[model samples]
Target: MALHFTDVEAALDHLLARLPAGLRVAAPLGLGKPHRLLNALYARVEADPSRPLHLYTALSLDPPSPGKGLQARFLGPFLARHFGEDFPRLAYVQAMKRDALPAHIEVEEFYLQSGALLDSAQTQRRYASLNYTHVAAALAARQVHLITQKVAREPGGDRLSFSCNTDLTADTVDAHLARGLPRPLLVAEIDPQLPWLGGSAVAPDGFFDVVIDPPGPHPSLFGLPRQPVGDADYAIGLYASTLVRDGGTLQIGIGALADALCHALVLRHTDNARYRQVLAALDPDLESHPAVRDSGGLGPFEVGLYGCSEMINEGFKRLVETGVIRRKVVDDAALMRRLADGTANLGDHARLERDGEYLHGAFYLGSPDFYAWLRDLPEVQCRAIGMRRIGEVNQLYGGDEGLERLQRRDARFFNSCMMATALGAAVSDALEDGRVVSGVGGQYNFVAMAHALPDARSVLMLRSTREAHGRSESNVRWNYGHATIPRHLRDLYVDEYGIADLRHASDEDCVVAMAGIADARWQAGLLDAAKAARKLRGDFAAPPRWQHNTPQRLGQSLAPFRRDGTLPDYPLGSDFTAVEQRLVRALAWLQASTATTSGKLRIAWQALTATPGRDDEALRRMDLHAGAGAGTWFQARLLGLALARTARDH
Candidate 1:
């Protein structure tokens, strides 16, 4: 039976009591449901009068959640009510956005809209879709509760299987006081798929107040607001989708590229249904399996596609509902049952839909529809894709025996890349300092898997250019930079410009192929550079036909589908609302701090102004002067793209 707590509060109380006075909690960040239970614990602690508590959360403030409103008013009071002056709340927000607000737990606006996803039945279903229903139980797990890490053995003393490396904040604490818990300890079992990093270690075997294990937590499910799909997005999607050959395991990351790719694939399944007929002719016994039935033989099968990701957001949920997502095979019935019921292994299954087939994640963020679904994930309906095995290649988990079973199955690995070179060098991660911007987080693993499977190939999606300062520029070409995936490992590269088959292409051929799809305006520049640097070889050279980024060509290629549909990059959704946009603009205008302040003001200004015009041609022509910062123009660019597409479609 799954470990049960009376309610969220009971679970938190259980955890709080076990924690040593100075211990810290490092939990998953972002649109996952981990925050829900976390907030509940904070609220409970906030209500307590005698115990002064210090709470800190790692979140980037620029992407403010609608949930923040509820947190400030409801949670802030609970903390103040319980701990009085003793409560100290700190939020660690990245200082990237110029207009980012200072972190505080208190409510500044009495009428600020609460950031909580609306509570409703539909929300429950959507949440269930992404597998966020069992967050409460997952936190109760032994491995999860304890923050464990791989630490070098301390040269002496009792060969510690696990040792408290440091507090959650990595502060040194009195070892005696730190050794607060007794032996035969309670460990909060965690999902192994979670991003592993050094530090924040938990105690090993002993040191338990009580050991509680709920199934692995589920991922967040978010729904995109009805928005228009741009030609650029559709084009990219079409190119990316072509890489998935009927039967390969798939992994799609967040963003428009992910949405576009998935959406386009869905379209292919409908428009070119017979392309997958080979799978239809297979035996009914194999076909009867949910996992097998879902493959729908659009391409050849390697291992078939098993969706393994850190996020269980709405896009994945859509795949499941549409029968595009299939069930995974497990040997044990009890495990499957637990997985279905929202209870299973932290390292194994996520929340139980049934034991072995559980869905799991650390947290969630989404619309009420998504939230509702999460609350009631039923067996046979939901599957949690945990983060623990996030980066592991299929071979590592299943081993040679499992590989043999999967050998016949070709898994096409679909992942996003930040940049794809003219020479077919694909960079998915940071090239500078080898300091990973995002952990190798499954990209390398999946890529390796793609190489291992004969039928498998990695599809790397590249946007030709991103709109900046109200102007389009090539994302395909830039000055010297390192590649995340070097030329040797290059496979398939996709862009709004087109698709480039890079695997066996010569360097010159690769450049010609990649440049063929680059923004028309940049093709000459790329070609000039390639020829000048002696990079061009053989008969490969830029052709004259690739001379312009004309709307006519893009139109013909993408064929203006429904405007109001999901795209890939902003796949799950964006929180920017019309009202919120206005407020942000107002906030930006009122704050006259510096170039940074004006830059933020510009984003809202352009978005609001641009939304009114069709074709967004006016907005596109409007120059924006934003100072250096990350994701500075996301809101404006997205709005402009949506507007342009909407106008064109209508």
Candidate 2:
């Protein structure tokens, strides 16, 4: 029998009364975060101010607002206005930023919500960057003292499902039991609406110490902020799409670039003609790029891919619905080997393996639409998309590497990073001075897994340059103080301009390839730096084959038809209406221009000096006019600037 309480306050009173001070609470990351319980605990600590409560979590959502400046001002309002309002303020974020919590409350995070956005020194000092594969190592070392999770009520049964957070939960429980540690206090907040993911999410009735189903929706559901795709991102995604061979394993991360890559893959699999057109517009000489020429293809997958991601995001759901993510992976090592060797097929495989899943993910966080999709899925289809322990999905050294290799053969762990050296060393987390941007989540594990697998490779993606603190900085540089994926584990690197296949290339070639993909303005400095370090020939110059490697040239060649609206912000398509798209584009331009010193002035100059003209279609679509209202002034200004750029281009 289990004690159930409708009042969270009463439940907390009963639970905390029994537990001593210095309670160690471990919760799930992302969507699985139990905000209500955490808030209650924080409130209790706030009242007492002496209880030493410890928190262990990763990639938990922070408040929408972080950092300071024009970009923050602009992006903050834009986000609050649309897309994300259901997300609530985080107790962890508040404590990290302002010291709002008790002094004894220590937060040890495996990953952060958005590390790059973090500017708090205290938050940086509090972070612990752990490899996703070795999370259990940290757990074992720390001796997990307590565990609480958000779970879904079982259908027609008195039980709970681990639901959205099976990633760390199952494995944590298994590892905890194996270590023979004293059984910690276990509790669950039951949300009946949460999907009952049957594979490993199912749990017996007596799993928790107590259950609470409070009557109102006090803890808002966490949702991932939807990132809009852009031209550079689309081009980068197009290049990456070509590298994903038919019937290979894919491991894509989250964010705009990942979404763009997903869109490009969809186009390749469903609409190859348009994909080629966009590719030609983005990389005219892709055929000249040797790595791409040797391994890349512009064709659709005759046999589709199997997703093996630590985070199964909204993109994977879309891929699954489109039939692009269709390869089933079995749990048994022998079955996987047979399937890999082509001796057994999904249709005729042993009946026992029928329960084999199409994708294996650690956890997920996406939009409200994505959660709705998950909630509405039938039981059988729900089983097709399974969640597993992070220890299993994140590492290659553990159990069934053979089966993992069979399932994730030709694995391409496509991930994003902040910076990398020309030699392929990467910095996915933290800055040179140890300011934590985002904690190293699973990129390290996937990179090592790729290196260990015979046919696997890691594909690292980033914009060649990113605007930070109002300055454009090169993401591909000669060297950096920190590295998430060191030079030894280097593989493929992609930017908007092109792909740098550095897997087996020499040091000099690595420099050349990195320079090839760098933003044209940053290339000379990078090459010069590499030479200063004696990594490249003293008199090195881009070979004759690299003559057309400037941004201006790339702009004209790779995306020649961008102005004609052939390459809209949403290249594949979007749910946003035409009016919304137009508005979003204008906002994007304004935001980018305002972020830097020269941007607003540049836009003003273009609006003044360039030919005064009209884009009636755009104005009509966005419902803005020359003399509507005060609201129209902003739109009108943006339209004029866009038109000015168009006049100059023509």
Candidate with top lDDT is 2
lDDT (C-alpha, whole model) for all candidates: 0.43, 0.74
Tell me the lDDT of candidate 2.
0.74
Instruction: Give the top-scoring candidate (TM-score).
Output: 2
Candidate 2: deviation at residue 17, Å? 1.7
Q: For candidate 1, lDDT tens digit of each residue in 156-190?
A: 33222122112121211122134453222222322
TM-score of each: 0.55, 0.88
Worst 10 residues of 1 by lDDT: 106-115
Error of 1 at 279 (Å): 22
Going through the candidates in the order shown, the clash numbers are: 117, 4
| Model 2 regions more than 4 Å off | 66-87, 155-157, 218-220, 284-290, 293-296, 345-353, 544-547, 557-568, 571-580, 596-650
Q: Model 2, 198-256: lDDT tens per residue?
A: 76667655778788887765444566656677666777788888888777888999888
